[model samples]
Target chain A: MSHVNGLPKKSPDMNGNVTITDCGDSALVAKAVGLDAEAAWRLVHALADALDAVRLTGGHDVVPTYDALLVEFDCTSTDHATVRSVLAHEAARLGPHPEPITPPRHFVVPVVYGGEYGPDLPEVAAQLGLSEGEVVELHSGSDLTVRCLGAPAGAPMTDGPPFPKPVPRLASPRTRVDPGSVAAAGRQAVICPMPSPGGWPLLGRTPVRILDLHSDPITAYQPGDTFRFRPITPQQWDEYADLSLADLVDSAGLANSADLVDHHG
Target chain B: MADTLTIRTAGIVTVQDLGRVGRSRYGLPANGAADQHSARVANVLCGNDERAPLLEITALDFACVPSSDILIAVTGAPADVTVEGGVRPQWEPVPVRAGETVKVSGIRQGLRVYLAVLGSFEADRLQGSCAPDTILGFGPALSTGDELVLRTACPPLDHPFSRIPLFRLKAPVPPFPTSWTIDVTDGPDRAEFGDTGRRLFDAPFTVTPRSNHIGLRLQGEVPRRVTKGEVLSRGVPIGAVEVPAGDELLVLHRGRGVTAGYPVLAVVTATGLSALGQVRPGQTISFRHRTLDQAVAAHRAQRNAIDALRSRVRTAFDALRIRAPAGT
Candidate 1:
């Protein structure tokens, strides 16, 4: 109930811009209405900064998705009112524009293209009216930044590379997609770190284990991290099966890592 | 001393603790015991810390054999716990000699059973938690013949009052009800459904057998559903009542993903999570609407009550010179 920028605290219903609503008793979601996903993403960072300034930080507790930010806290300690107040106060404090939260790290995962590594690769190439090699050229050709980490546990979802057209998903999702299966749907490409059900079209598979319980650095990539795929042969894929994310990043060489992008579109 | 417990039979078994908190940003769900209160009760009765590693056995036959003398507590869905072929009580500590076979089966009234050993239970850890995340293939699932090593064996039970376990003297167990009417709060997308989402509380929804720790899929009147690819992907909560574009209404549990794309119309309150976790498949569940403030108050009350029970148990253990770390 302390003063926030000399304004009396507003209830959950009074937030001007952000639609701050209760996700549950323990979590709150502030989604920016009438804003594009990018603008919403910026608002998420602003709210995160606003929360951090007030000593509310649990690095992993604040989940910033494509547009909205879901903030979770212990209901026993931090009540719902305080969280909403902070969001409204910060929104009022910083009017108009907020800076983007760009991911600072980059990783190039070695993947085996086509065949069993990704069953949809051939069809993806055929549907796009491009040759198989051209498909690989288009798929592994761009540096895609992660939109967010979601669902299948640490699978990084990113905007798809410049395929001639927005790639289509399967008519019905497969019951299971093998772990390390790299998939594409519409304009997004993602890596399925575990065997789970999915409808995305598979382009290839990465031998580099992105997320593992027993390994150090369980999940190396975060939102905004630059994620790129480097096509490797089936043998190279086999070699990468046991390697960790650290191993791939280290071997890819940090200096030349920035040169991996071609902007094929 | 590296003593181990061998899993004799595994039926949907895993190891869990309080769960990995604040790790959702890394795309990890705070996967833990489906029923948090029962897990803590089991650990408290066994003279171990609430966050100590323990076994989470779902509805199915589960048995284990200890390699050393240890005290264990079995709590959750009422179950027949047999130590060395003899029945042992649930919700209190029971001692088992080295090489004794402990069996937990016929789990009735609930879905999960917690088995907490008296000392430090060891397992491969991630983010300082031993809880398994099956969706991510994160922790080892308990398999028959899998040996679970205990870093600290049970303390010598030769104290003057060792004739009777001191920790067993005080264990406050709350009611475990078969009929459930869980409390839920309006979610961010509740306005999207408006009148349609009211069907969630219209009647009792049957928990379909398709349910698991990932989510409790209920077969009921489907509200105006949001197609799978409709909403932007966002982080979902432990007890989120997600409305998918399907015949079933899904209520997410602890084992759910950190982020999902389905639109959530309402979220079950924390006060209702334990009951949601313990209900058996095919059981009817109804939702009661509560304001966010009321929901928070109920959570604090439940937590405060658990803290009181923990302190009392710790005091009794101290009388026997037994160490029970303060519950956080």
Candidate 2:
């Protein structure tokens, strides 16, 4: 990691680096290279926070991937040099643990475990030497940070529980994992909001709709948001059939209540 | 009475526009039309705003009849456009009488064609875009017998023979080429393929028939990885030239997801993407190296040409006292 202008940065930004690259003429990326998952996540969020604090005309998105921050803009209105310069300025200002774009929200996602919902549940449990109940208990009891949200859009990528051993990826990935599939690999967990090809072991399926393309901010679980998976029996699945991630987030009972104001949470 | 266009013979059709913006953070691709250049030209020629939804016709016969007389534009590809057996030219807006079927068939030289009615065509919209997610088969997939209601009953021109000379003065785009030369810049994972890296530019690639809106699969000299490592799944831009394990070089199109783990050796320029969008199956493409600045300049040139046309049309509309259709 290279220091920005040789200035000392506190905590997350300390020893963290960002290498900005141009993807064609339309998109720009600020990648955090040679960092672990947690460190990369922090550095990316910091950069994102710094950039989002200001208003940029012609900018389309500030998408946070697992280890990179992608900023897309309308090239007709802005040039790559202008956008890259702004990115560098914003990145240089990320001195420490930066804030989030919006106040962090919490959600309790209800999921149904095993059998048809999770074909790999039995194999995963056997490999981990934990019973199905124990696996569910350990996974549902842990709190996870929404590390990133991307791929097919609005899919929440978060942290899984500390298992005795890291879960291995599937030998052959599924051609299409249906939406709302709760999957886990190593210490990471992901909720598929859209049907996509995935290698992570499917632990369960959630009834709640995590992404609605028609709505802005498609998913409630942005980076820095907190969520906990609560296991449910198959019989109670229909109870949350029509619920969405927003429905639960709006009821988070935060200080601002329903308003998505910045509360530094 | 609702102005409608009833499909007589439908091919693979979908509604497209300039595409959705400010939705990528949610993983939504900037999917509007596969060939934005043609789509914009079609919309602007018919005096519709650039964002107005139009039909993107692929590889089959497509015919529709408007409930009322309206002006329409056909652009992209070298498809034959005919109105009630009379041949009409592409690129320039032409007046179509009510009940006369406008048919686009015999598309031999290209992959896609854009059809824009003068008024707004009602289609399923998601996040303010009519462009469907072709990968997931989500959104409106137009088919035979489907009647698309035009929200605004646009007043037709005097007659087909009374075509506006100003719009007609614009010539049709040149015929699609059998061979394409695309410009590309080095990608993030360009170093992955060592010796074979140069093969990407040196050899020619053929666009395979298995291609779709998501990506164009190509058959060419496979750039086998010299050293293999798990490439981190990072956010990718459109026009990425990915090397999959199966030896097929995949050039991602507009419908691809925002993030991917595949090794991207090069990224096609904006102008290259537009050209690739029109490439028919079995057509050859040769990649040429370009600096980032050159790529941007080329794209800007292409966009500037369209912008100039847009302004000219705006002035033409003012002179003709034409108003945009409703529900734009």
TM-score for each model: 0.84, 0.86
Candidate 1 regions exceeding 4 Å error are: A1-17, A33-36, A49-60, A89-103, A108-141, A161-171, A212-216, A229-265, B1-6, B65-69, B97-101, B151-178, B226-229, B325-328
The segments of candidate 2 whose C-alpha lies over 4 angstroms from its true place after superposition are A1-16, A33-39, A49-55, A122-138, A163-171, A247-265, B134-138, B151-167, B171-175, B226-232, B311-327
RMSD of each: 4.4, 5.0
lDDT of 2 by residue, A1-265 (tens): 1222533212113233677777776777887766667667777877766666665656777777777888877677776666666666666577434444456677888989888888888899999999988888888996677777667655777776777777877877787998889988866778888777787899999998877655666666677777788888899999999998888763543654334333232
Clashing pairs in 1: A160-A187
Interface RMSD of each: 1.8, 2.2
Worst 10 residues of 2 chain B by lDDT: B163-172
* Chain B vs. true chain B: TM-score per candidate: 0.90, 0.93
Clashes of each: 1, 2
Q: Which lDDT value does model 1 have at A226?
A: 73
Error of 2 at B111 (Å): 1.4
Candidate number with greatest DockQ: 1
